[model samples]
Target: MDRANIIHDLLDWIETHLDQPLLLDNVAAKSGYSKWHLQRMFRSTTGHALGSYIRERRLSQAAQALRSTPRSILDIALQFHFDSQPSFSRAFKKQFGKTPAVYRRTPAQGMTEASPQSSAQQPNYHNESPNLHLLYNGKCTDGKCTQWMGQR
Candidate 1:
């Protein structure tokens, strides 16, 4: 397939797997490309790193959940694979210039894009604590977050 087609397929795959842990190695394997090649191609085509694209999409979905549902910020953050509320808030504020709580309260003042559907309709992803810690925070560290070690 062409580069554009490959990128499109990659994006579609990402969207479908938004609720799951999206590791770079896993994505590379799924796309049948080496991690380096996939990163280079994705960046060249999308003007953003693959990791950045995934992070942005996850944050966008979390924003939707924040605004459209009564779910707690922590639940929304965890649902989108964020390690903690603080880290999620930092990224959310960086991206939308407002915290999730603030955005939920006044969505119009933040990014105004419409969500594809209500977050309520999404399946309950009852992921284990270990998996959540590994995917979101990197290390367990006695199950106490001493610092924001995950991606911003």
Candidate 2:
């Protein structure tokens, strides 16, 4: 298959399997490519390291869980495969600009309420090539906050 098609399939697989251990070796095996080659293709295609994308995706899901679930921060962190709460907090803060606890306690600006349904839905991701930037602007519309994916 072509590189674009291969990358698309890889992205889908990664999304579905986010809850599992997704090491570079594991993903490379799944992609039927050497780790080095897969990394090159992934970076050239997505403009981000394969590992970074996976980590960001996990962080994104963890953010949703934090917003909607009564689950503890540590539980959420563990669920997303972070090694520890402190590590999870560091990554979460780096990505979302708030520690998970603070993030849960303070509703996002312009967002008045959290819906359980939103937590069940997947975060918005597209199949386009090139880099993406997740804009968690907390801009609410019709009582729902939206996260936007933009070209980098």
Candidate 3:
């Protein structure tokens, strides 16, 4: 398999495993690459660091849960594997520019994209948006280069 395929597969795997522990060491082991190599390859292909991508995806999924469920903020935070409600709140606020409670109270339409800007060469990602199709900026013979996450 090529580097592109590896990255696409990894993205799908990451999405499906978001609720679990997804530390970089574990992800590197799963990818059969050294941490250094994997980081370099992932950053080169996706224009985002592997760790940052995982974090943003988790935050995005948490945002979806917040909008669609009546679950408590702590529950949502813990569900997404955050260390604690306060940590979750800090990351959430950093990603979405609002507290989870405020975000839940606001209408979805009132929300704006608060994700970090993609690099000049890659497609953009919305850090707290729901139902994103994460595309690998590469050439693929098959249409397996995109991974959809946070789908309702």
Candidate 4:
């Protein structure tokens, strides 16, 4: 019915099937919006494009796999659908400023917080994260404020 609903529906599908192929048209169709309209809505409301959102989400999952599993960098990269190590490495470096090796060796250290400003949130956002709780317990009571769920 609205931009938030559109984005929420898209993200719900994303979370459930991160490993599956995603198409903008499919997402748009699911949300009952045109592809272009959904793209514009995502950019206007979230300030990041859908492609970037999917990439970030994939990277976040890759980082999590690196930390939680004994998998190698290549394995993690492949797990997130990245075709090659260099491509994955470049993206990982660009977003996180570290390679998979360094990140896996120490996930909590050398970590940078996603400023309330940037589109990047911490990559460790599995179900148990406090952020998930925030999403569940918080709401925009006024419907106009852009504040986060728990923030005042």
Off by over 4 Å in 1: 107-111, 117-152
Give the per-residue lDDT of model 1 (tens digit) for 1-152. 66766766676578779889999999999999999999997777655578976877787778777777899999999998989999999988887677788777883553335344224433211111111211221111332222222332
Candidate 4, run of 10 with poorest lDDT: 132-141
Worst 10 residues of 1 by lDDT: 125-134
What is the model-wide C-alpha lDDT for candidate 2? 0.70
- Give me the overall lDDT of model 4: 0.59
Model 3 compared with the native: what TM-score?
0.76
**lDDT of each residue in 6-67, candidate 4, tens digit only:** 56556657765666666777777877878898788767754457776677667767777777
Q: Predicted candidate 4: what Cα RMSD to the true structure?
A: 7.1
lDDT winner: 3
Rank list by TM-score: 3, 2, 1, 4
lDDT of candidate 3 over 1-152, digit per residue (tens): 88878987787588779889998999999999999999998887666678988988889878888887899999999998999999999988887778999998988675553433355654334454343334333333343334323332
User: Clashing residue pairs in candidate 3, if any?
Assistant: none
Candidates in order have lDDT scores of 0.66, 0.70, 0.74, 0.59
| Runs of candidate 4 exceeding 4 Å displacement | 110-152
Cα error, residue 67 of model 1, in Å, equals 0.8
**Rank by lDDT, descending?**
3, 2, 1, 4
